[model samples]
Structure formats: C-alpha cells, structure tokens
Target chain A: MEHFIETIGRNMFAIFGVMALVGGLLMIASKSAIHSVLGFLFAMLNIAGCFLALEAEFLGVAQILVYAGGIVVLFLFVVMLVEVSKKKEGEVFQLQSRYAVAAVAVGAAMFLAVFRKAFFGVASPEALVLRPELAKGLDVAHQNAQAVSRGLFADYLLPFEILSVILLVALVGAVVLAKTERV
Target chain B: MVSLNAVLLISFLLFSIGIAGVLIRRNALIILMCVELMLNAANLNFIAFARHNGSVAGQAFALLVMGFAAAEVAVGLALVVALYRRRDTVQVDDINLLKG
Candidate 1:
C-alpha cells in the first residue's frame, strides 16, 4: 500500500510539473492577451499542485490564494482596462524574430549545460533524498499550517512585519499610478 | 517520491519559457505575466529545496517571494495602465520615449 501511494504521488508531481511548463510556453506563444492570462492561470495552479506534491501544503494553499486568486485577477483586470483587443493582430510579437530565436537558443543551451553537469554527471542520487530532520516535521500527522505559522511568527517575524509594510507601499503606488487626475 | 532533480528541471523549463516570452512579446501585460511565471518558477525551487533539506525556511522564503510577487504585480500593472493611457498602446517597441 505504501509503495502504491508513493507511485501515485510521483506521477502526480510529474503531471503537474509538465502542466506548469507547458502552460508557461502556451502563455508565451499565444497572441491574445486573454489567452496569455488563461495560460498564466493554468501555470499558477499547476505550480500550486507541485507545491503540494513536495509536501508543503501551507505554501501550496498560499500559492492558490495569492497567485491564482489575487495575481491572475489583477492581470485580467488590467487586460480588460487596457483595450488590448484593439491592437493589430500582427503586432503581437515584435518585428525582430531573430532576437527571440537567439534568446531561446541561449536559454536552451543553459538548461542543457546545467542538466548535463548537475543530474547526469557529478551530483549523486543521494542528494535528492529528503533530509530526515526536515521530513519529520512535515509528516502527514503534523499540521502544516501550524508549523508554517510558527515559523513565520517566531523565526521569521521581522520579515513578516516588513512584508506588510511593503504591501502597503505597493497598494499606495498602484493607486497613485492608476488613478486618473481630475480636472 | 519524485526526485528533486525532476522538480528543479520543471522549474528551469518554466523560467526559460518566461524569458522567451519576455523577449518576444510586444504587449507590456504579457511581459508582466511572463515575469510572474518566472517568479513562480523560483518559488517552486524554494519549495522543492525546502522539502529536500527537511527545513521550513525554504517554505518561509517562498511565502516571502509570493508576497513580493503580489506587490510587484500590483505596481507593475499600475505602471502598465499608466503607460497605456499616456501612449495609447501597450506595445514595447512603439513606446520609445525613454530610449537612450
């Protein structure tokens, strides 16, 4: 039974990880802004799934709440407000296709170089194993949210407080920038 | 269990796709979405490493990154909206007022 569960979990991770990568690619390839937003939504949800697969349930839920709920909505609102449908369809991509090709090639080369050295060559398989101490806190019996909150309020209190201030500044900035001046 | 390498590879692929989108897309909104994708990729890395190392710090950092990403998107979209109003289009190529 345990082995069966492990297999299912591994498969879930593979599926969601591929979904995220493909969704990101679709976002890039789509011409319509709406389509790109949809793709971005798909990618964000799958990344949340990947987070769950990694056993970080709190972060996974936060991913859905913050990203899928908040960020994607913001993107959609801007898309609607901007009148992107009015732009000429052919103008979706910049004229310099050559630069895109070069950029993709460079990105692919970087991936291959790192993959070859890290996974296939020097890094041992043991490196992939979860450390026993970390795994102990994350076991299925423990409350992930409680653990996360404990960490946030105790060890990470300063950053937590600063994040709230940063969020406030961003809120003010957005309002100032998006608000139209009244005559 | 899924290997850490597999998870990291997925993140890398998403990040690379994001880079391509930022380079190729003309619309500022799409570019911003692509940047979000890249940020999510980094968040995935942080989570995966956190799991592998058996530490909560990775998850904490990921949460922090998420907060920062939210702030960034809010400001970024506001800037995009302001730019569109000023220039009448979101195409990056045409908005060359700041070009040096």
Candidate 2:
C-alpha cells in the first residue's frame, strides 16, 4: 500500500512537471503576446501543483495567489494595453538563432549529465538529511503555513519588512513610468 | 512523497526551457514571462531542498523570490508599455535606441 501511494505521487509529480514545461514552451512558441500570457498562466498553475506535491502548502497557495492570479493578470493587461494584436508580429524569434540554439543545447546537455550522476549515484542526495535541533517546531506534523509564517515574522523579519518596502517602491515606479502625463 | 531527484529534474528542465525562451523569443512580454518561469524554477528548487533538509527556510526564501518577481514584472511590463508608447514597438529588435 505504501509503495502504491508513492508510485501515484511520483506519477502526479511527473504530470505536473511535464505540463509546466509544456506551458513554458508554449510561452515561447506562440507569436501572439496574449497567447504567451495564457501559456504562462498554465505554467504558473502547474508550478503551483508542483509546490503542493512537494508539501509546501503555503508556497502552493501563494504561488496561485501571486503568480497565477496577480502577475499573470498584470501581463494580460499590459499585452492588451500595448495592442500587440493590432499588428502582425513579423519574425517571432531572434535573428541570431544558430548561436542561441548551440549555447542552450550545450548548457542543457551539461546540466543533464551532472544531474543524472548527482541524483542516481551510490549515495543519493535524498539520503543527506539535516533535521536541526533548533527547529523542533518545524516538524512535518505542524501546519506548514503556521511554521512558515513564524519563520517569516520571527526569523526573517528584517528581510520581510524590506520586501514590503521594495514592493512599495516598485508600485510607485511602475505608476510613474506608465503615466501618460508628466509627473 | 515525491522523489527529490525527480523534483530537481523538473526544476532544471523548467529553468532550461525558460532560458531557451528568453534567448529565442523576440517579444518583450514573452521574454518577461520567461524570466518569471525561470524564477519559478528556482522556487521549485528551494522548496524541494527545504523538504529534503526538513526545514522551512527554503520555503521562506521562495516566498521572497515570489515577492521580488512580482515587483519585477510590474516594473518590466511598465517599461514595455512605456517603450511601446515612445516608439510604438514591442519587438526587442526594433527598439535599439541604445545602439545609437
């Protein structure tokens, strides 16, 4: 029974991972900007699936709320605002394709070779575990969101506060940049 | 539980796809989305590593990445729109004012 559950989980992870990659590909493959946004939306949703499968419950929900909902909708607004559909986009890919393809292909091959050895070797990476004595409260039984929130508001309070400031500056800058009239 | 190796593979592939998209695509918005894809891939790695290490720090960092990426997209799209307004082009090739 345990093995069956494990197999099912693995299969679901594969499904989510593969679908996410497909969506990412679709983002590049489609010429239409709106279509790319749609693909990105699909990718973000599947990535959220990947997050949930990994048991990062807080991240999974945040992924949906932030990436899938907020950022993607913002992309759609910009795509329409710019009126990409009004004009036919000639030459969807960059001019220097041959070099880019070669670079990406070589990089991908290197990565795969390294990952295969690292993952499948005698001492698997999964075996290396570090359950810190300090984080006793972060056990699996604890609710992930509560643990995460505690970590955020307690351990990472400074950075969390800074992130809010960054968000404020970014929003103001975006508005200033996009405004038609002089500031 | 999903295998750590499998999660790593997915993250790597997603990141590679994102790199390919950025290098291959000409549309500014598509490229921006690709950047987001790459960021998501990194988040996957952080979460998976967090799980493997039995800690929540990775999740916290992933949240930080999400927040930063959101801000990045807002600014990026704003720039895209601003460029569109100025020269009426979203293609990366056409907006080469810096080439001057």
Candidate 3:
C-alpha cells in the first residue's frame, strides 16, 4: 500500500509537470485576454498539484486560493471592465517568429546545461518514498497542519510579517490607482 | 529518460518563451500572462527541487511566490485599466505620461 501511494504520487508529479507546460503554451498562443487569463489559471492549478506531490498541502491550498481563485478572477474582471475599440487592438497578437526561435534556442541551451547536474542520475524510477511524518496527518489533512504553521510562525516569522505589510501597501496602492480622482 | 530534470527543462523552456514574449510584445495583457508564466516556471522549479531534495521548503516558497504573483496581477490589471481610461489605449508605446 505504501509503495502504491508513492507510485501514484510520482505519476501525479509528472502529470502536473506536463500540464504546466501545456498551460504555458496556451498562455503564449492565446489571442484573447480572457483566454490568457484562463491559461494562467490552468497553469497555476498545475503548480498547485505539483506542490501537493511535493508534500506541501498547505502551499497547494494557498496556491489555489490566491492564484486560481483570486488573481485570475481579478484579471477577468479588469479585462471586462476595460473598453477597447477594434482599432485600439493594435499589435496585440503580432508575434514575431524570430523572437520565438531565439527564445527556443536560449531555452534549449539552458536546459542542456542543467540537464547533467539535475537529471543525469534520476533514472526515472517509479518508486515513491513515503515519509512517516506525512502519513500522520493523512487522516485529517487540516486537523493540525503543523509543518506549514510552524514554518510560517517560527522559522519564517519575519518574512511572513513583512509580507503582510507588503500586502497592505499593495492594497492601498491598488485602491489609489483605481480611484477616479487623485487623493 | 523522463526524469525530474526533463520535466524541469520543459517547464523552463515554456517559461523562457513566455518571458521572451513579454519582453518583445507590446500587448499589456499578454505581458501579464507572460509574467504569470514566469512565476509558474519558478514554481515548477521549486516543486522539482523539493521532490528531489525531500524537503517541503521549496513547495512553501512556491506558494509564497504564487501569492505575490496573484497580487501582482491584480495590481497590474488595475493599472492597465486606469491607463486605458487615461490614454484610451493599452499599447506600451503610449505610456509616456511623465517623460520629462
């Protein structure tokens, strides 16, 4: 049973990886703003799945809540709220193939350089290693949630508090930017 | 061999393409999508490294990145809307309000 769970987890990680790639491509090729937003949402969802496979359930939930649920919806709302005329849609879809070729070239170079250090010995094994600590929390996923809370409050307390401050600033800035008049 | 590195490589490629598009394109929405793509790429890297290292920190960082990315998109879109209202357009070339 443990081995079975590991195999499922490994396979899920691969699936999430593929999904992320597909979502990225869709985001690039999407002509409409709505489509781009949807593509981004799909990509974020795949990343959340990756977080789950990495045994970071808290992060997965946060990804879903903040990204897929919050940001994409805001993007959709803004797209609808903005009024763009047909003539004003200039250069929105004009993608040059040369740039894409160059991007692919650069990506290939980076992949090749990192492939040796990262994936050479990976062997593509299907074996999953289930940590005993993770299984303790499986019965009730959110009952205690110690790893995340501990990390946030103790180890990462300073960064966490700083992030809250940044969030407040962002909220105020957003409101000011969106307001009709200068204040 | 379809290893974790392969997965990371693919994600990186997609992400770089997204970045290149954002840098080269003039469309604001597409640029925002590209930014999202870059964040996703980093997220993929975090997860891949987490799995390889057997640590949850990478995944936690990815989550944090996602939060910031979402907030960034919200602020970016709102700014875009405000820009549209002021200039009646969304082209990158036209945002020269303070070119003094």
Candidate 4:
C-alpha cells in the first residue's frame, strides 16, 4: 500500500515535469494561431498537475476548469472568427529597440532572481504540510473539495462573488465592443 | 525531489517566448494568444508559490489572474472583431485607420 502511494506521488511529479517541457516547446514553436491556443491548453494542464504535486488540489482543479476549458475555447473561437488572410509582409509590432532589449533583460533578471529565491535562497524550504490521513494513501482530492467549498464560503466569500460580477461586466463589454458601427 | 525552481524556470522561458511572439508576430490574434501565454506563465508561478508556502493566497491570486485574463481576452477579441469589421483585415500592418 505504501509503495503504491509513493509511486503515485512520483508519477504525478514526473508527469508534470515532462508536460512542462513539451508544452513550453510547443508554445514556442507554434506559428499558427490555432496551434498556439492548443499549446497553451497543454501547458495549463501541466501547470495544474504541478499544483497537485504541490498539494494544492483546489488550484489544480481551478486551473484546468477556468484556464484550459474557458479561456482556450474563447481564443479558438476568436481566432476562427477573425481571418488573417494577408501575407505576413510588413512589421506586425512596434516595439522600440532599446525598450524591447531592456524589457527582455529585466524580465530575464527578475526570473533568475525569483528562481534562486525559490530553490536556493532563504525561501528554499519545502514546508511540506500534509495531513496524516492524506499521506496514508487516502484520496486528498475529496477532502480538498470539501475544504475548498468551506474556504470559499467562509473566508473567500467576497472575492468569489466579486469574480462573478467581473465576468458579467466582461461579457457585457465584449458585446458592446463587438457591436458594429452604424452604417 | 524536483525543485520548484525547475518549474519556475520553464515558466519563465515560456513567458519570454510568448513576449517574443507578441513582439514579432504581425497577426493580431496571434499576439493576443501570446499575451494569454504570458498570463498563464504568471499563473503557474503563483500556483507554485502557493503550494510551497502552504498558503491559499497564491491560489486566490491565481484565480484573480484568471478572471483578469478572461476579461482581457473578451475585450481583446471584441477589439479584434471591431477591427476586422472596420478594416476587413486582422493584420497589424493593415490597421492604419488612425495614422495620419
């Protein structure tokens, strides 16, 4: 039983690791609009699994449900609706040379700093907080679902409702913006 | 034990590539998709930190980021739809309606 539990944990981690690599590569290499959306979905799946490995099942579920299911579909629908028929001839972007270089340099440096902090700096503790029952091969996902519901109602009530309002506004705004101008 | 750093490093690289695509791609829809990539990269970082910290705050923030991303996508796609209606082209180079 213990061996089974350990194997499951390890397999989950390994899956996330490989998914991250493949998803990243695909997202980078995708030139087509549809391919990029699909790549992002794959990457989201990997990230959600990583959240599970980190013991945040609530986040893992939300990541898959909201990001992969909701956003990617919207992207594909929009891509299909808008046609890019012209040849890729003229410059598509207007990034200033110095600003672009600086942006990349700063982003890279920040990422490295963050990476060091996460893996090697003062914040390099795993701080594993597993419930005893959870470590004993019991399904954490079920418990997490209950806890997530309690958390949402108890502590996260306001933010939860606020998000719904935000979504409503966005839907309305999208309709308004997409409305054609009078002839 | 696979370190969180490894995951974060991959996320950063993905984000950089997305930014590059946004900068280099002339297709507006593709650029929007790249922007989505960038936001997802940030969300991954948030979830990793959430798991490491044994805190729910990271997940909360990630959800907020998701909401913002969704809203951004809506408005952005609407803009794309609007642009396509006005100019009949979705290419960035083709959008010169405002240029003098």
Candidate 5:
C-alpha cells in the first residue's frame, strides 16, 4: 500500500512537470500577447508545483508568492497599460519564419546532444540513485522555510544582500525609464 | 520516486520552447515572458539536481535566480514601455533606430 501511494505521488509529480513544459510552449506559441502572459502564469504555477514535488517547500511557496502574486500581476499591469493596436494585432510573428525553423532545429539538436551525453555517457547502466544522507537532510528541510532561511542568512548572506541592492537598482531604473516627464 | 533524468528532460523541453518563442515572437513583452520561461527551466534543473545530490545550495541558488529574474522583468518591462512611448510600437523589427 505504501509503495502504491509512493507510485501515485511520483506520477502526480510527472504530470505537474509535463504541465510546466507544455505551459511554456503555450506561452511561446500563442498569437496574442495576453494569451502568452496567461500561459506564462500557468507555467509559473506548475513550476512551483514541481518545486513542491521535489520537496523544496520553501522555494515552492516563494515561487507562488513572488512569481504568481507579484510578477504575474506586474505583467498584467504592463499588458493593460500598453495599447495593442489593430495593426499590431495581425503582426504576431516576425518576417523570419524560416529562421524560426532553424532555431527550433538547433535547439532540438542541443537538447538531444545533451540528453544523450547525460544519460548514456557513462558505461554503467545503473538506475538513478538518491544520496541517502542528502535525502535525509532534504526530508528534514522539506516544507521547512527555516532551513532555507538559515542557509540564505548564514551561507549565502553576501549574495542575499547583493540581491537587495540589485532589486533597488532595478526599482530606480524602472521608475526612471517608465516615468514620462510632463512639460 | 521520480527520476532526476525525467525532471531534467522536462526542463530541457521547456527551455527549448522558450528559445523557440524568443526566436519567433516579435513582441518584446512575449519575448520577456519567454526569457522568464527559460529562467524557470533553469531553476527546475537546480531544484532537481539539489534533490538528487542532497544539497540545499541548489535551492538557494534557485532562489537567487528568482530574485534576479524579478529584477530583470522590472527593468525589461520599463524599457519596453519607454520604447513603446518613443516609437509607438513594441515590435522588435520596428525598433531599428540603432542600426547604424
């Protein structure tokens, strides 16, 4: 019964993972800008679910809070502010559809090459193995925001501080760029 | 348990889709969204590897990446808005004033 439940959980994770991928594709392939943004939201939510499946509960919640709550709203605001005229509505793609095909081919080739190397490069045909010690640690850290905060504050303190500065700079830059001067 | 390879494959596919979107899409906003998709794909890889290797560093880095992504979106959207104001359009092909 435990094994069955575990299998079910694993399958659910796979479904979420696939959903994330498909949502990304949808975002890219959609004709309307609003549709693309909606697709991005879907992708973001599913990615957060993926984080939860991996037992990174803090990251998952942060993804939801930061991405779904903050970023998506920001995107929607920008979309609403920017007027899409009738002329622009028809021009969904660029002039280089052929180039897009080439791009897709190149990307697919890269994925295949890397996938082949990662999976088949080693001579040993062993199944995926989880590190027991790390697994135990992660199991403890799972759904534990405190563990993530400890690591952020202790080990990655400098980066955390630097990120705050970056955010501030971005805020200032955005204001400067978007604000129109009234003459 | 789900295999790391499966997770990685999904990430790769998402990344490729983002690439395709970036290449094909003319709208700067959609392109920005595609870039976010790519970033999310990379983050998925980080979390997956962290889980497989049993380290918290990957998750930490992923968080940092998310922060950077948010900053990037802010600046990027601002630039887009400014461009639209100046050129009255957000199409990449239309913004060719810098093509000297």
Candidate 6:
C-alpha cells in the first residue's frame, strides 16, 4: 500500500510530462500556424506543471507569465500582423519530409549518445556538489520561492542586472527591425 | 517524488520532438515554436537537476534561461516580420534570393 501510494505520487509528474510531449508534437505537426501556436501554448502550460511538480513554484509561475502571457501573445500578434499567404498543402512542409525525419532521428540518437556519455546520467549520485557560493543552500525555510529568490538576489545579482540590459537591447532591436518606415 | 531519470527522459523526448519539428516544418513561425520547445526541454532539465541537488542554482539558471528565451523570441519574430515585408511569405523554402 505504501509503495502504491508512492507510485501514484510519481505518476502525477509523469502525466504532466506526457502531456508536454504530446503538446510539443501537436505544435510541430499542425498545418496552420495558429494551430501550431496553440499547441505550443499547451506544451508551455504543461511544462509549468512539470516545474511545479519539481517544487519550483517560482519558476513555474515565471514560465507561464513569460511564455504564455508574453511570448505566445507576441507570436499571435506576428501571425496576425504579417499577411503570409498559406502555401498549398503540398508546400506547407519542406520537400522530402521522410528524409528530414530520418535525419532528425539519427541526430536525436547521436544527441542521446553524446549527452549520456558526458553528463551524470540517470544513475547519478543524489548529492551533487553545487558551486561554493550557493553551497550554503536553501535554509530551514524550505520554501521554493524563497530559495529561488535568494539565488537570484543574493548570488546571481550581477547576471540578473545584465539580463535586464539584454532585454532592453532586444526591445530596441525588435522595434528597429519591425519598423514600418525606414529612415 | 519524481525520479531524476524520469524527468531526464521526458526532457530528452521533448527535445527530440522539437528537433524533428524544426526540420520538418517549413513555416518560419512554427519553426520558431519548435525552437521554444527545445528551450523548454533544457529548462526542464535545469529545474529537475536543481531539485535533485537540493540547491537553488538550477532554478536560478532556469529563470535566467526564461529571460533569454523571451528576448530571443522577440528578435526572431521581428526577423520573421521583416522577411514577410520583403517577400510576403513566411515559408522558409520560399525564402531564397537566387531566383531570376
């Protein structure tokens, strides 16, 4: 009975994981661009669920806000703003689809082989050695948001600030690129 | 508790699917979405590892990754818009300049 309960506990994350994969597949396989975006949205939400399952509460919320609220909206606006004439069904996908799928399969196999050889694989040790700065680790609070905030504000402040500048630059670059009239 | 292996497996599958999508799709926008799928897979790995290590750094890095993904999508979609303006098509195969 105890083992059964534990299995159920583990299955929750599995459900989210499966849904995420399905969503990603849907995003890729859809014919219409809007349909593809909708599929991507489904996948993003399920990924947030996966984050929450991993107990990364803050990260989960940020995923929804950034991807769902902001990124998807941007994609939708572009889909609407641009008057892209949908090509004929035969031309929707690139030529030689079967060959591309095969190549991707080979690529995925190589990817798996390389990563499995390098990283601490599934059978890795639980006690991973973190950086000395963050080795202090989460406190007794054990709060997901607290730990993440401490990491960002206390340890990663410089990168955090630099990221802001990057976002600003990207914002300016986007405006310049998408401007209607050229100077 | 989700095992580290399970999470890793999920991330791997998601990433493979993303790669296939990118190669198979001709729409620039959908290809961009496939790229987002790949990024999410990487982020999933980060959070899973963070949880496994009982540290906050993985989550922290995931947050940073999210920011980068946002900035990336902004620039990429802008490029898509620019492409549309010049040639009026979002199909990648049609985005060639060697034609007469």
| Residue-level lDDT tens digits of model 1 in A104-153 | 89879987888877772222222222335434555433577766666666
Backbone clash pairs for candidate 5 read: none
TM-score of each model, in listed order: 0.87, 0.90, 0.78, 0.76, 0.86, 0.85
Ranking by DockQ: 2, 1, 6, 5, 4, 3
Q: Note the Cα lDDT for every prediction shown.
A: 0.82, 0.84, 0.68, 0.72, 0.81, 0.83
Judging by TM-score, tell me the better candidate of 1 and 5. Answer: 1
lDDT of 3 by residue, B17-99 (tens): 67766866666877887887787777777766655665546655665676677568767887887788788777776778888
Residue A165, model 4: lDDT of 91
DockQ for candidate 1, C-alpha atoms: 0.60
Q: List the residue pairs that clash in candidate 3.
A: none
Off by over 4 Å in 4: A1-18, A84-99, A113-142
The best-first sequence of candidates by lDDT reads: 2, 6, 1, 5, 4, 3
Write the residue-wise lDDT of candidate 3 on A1-183 in tens digits. Answer: 999997866588677867877787777676676777787788879878866765567667777888777877787777776644435455655456677767677767876777766673544332222246544544323432465454445455676676677777778888888788756
Chain B TM-score, structure 5: 0.98
What tens digits encode model 2's per-residue C-alpha lDDT throughout B42-70? 99999888877766688889999999999
Which candidate has the top score in TM-score? 2
**Which residue pairs show collisions in model 6?**
none
- Per-residue CA lDDT of model 4 for A1-183, tens digit only, reads 999998877667557856865775676466666776788788778878877776667778887888788878887887777645644435534556668868888888987887776663333455333445433553433566554444445567788788889889989999999987774
Better of 5 and 6 by TM-score: 5
The residue-level lDDT of candidate 6 at B7 comes to 89
- Model 6 misplaced stretches (Cα beyond 4 Å): A1-8, A83-89, A95-100, A110-141, B98-100
- The top-ranked prediction according to lDDT is 2
Fraction of true contacts reproduced, model 6?
0.69
The residue-level lDDT of candidate 2 at A30 comes to: 88
Worst 10 residues of 3 chain A by lDDT: A122-131
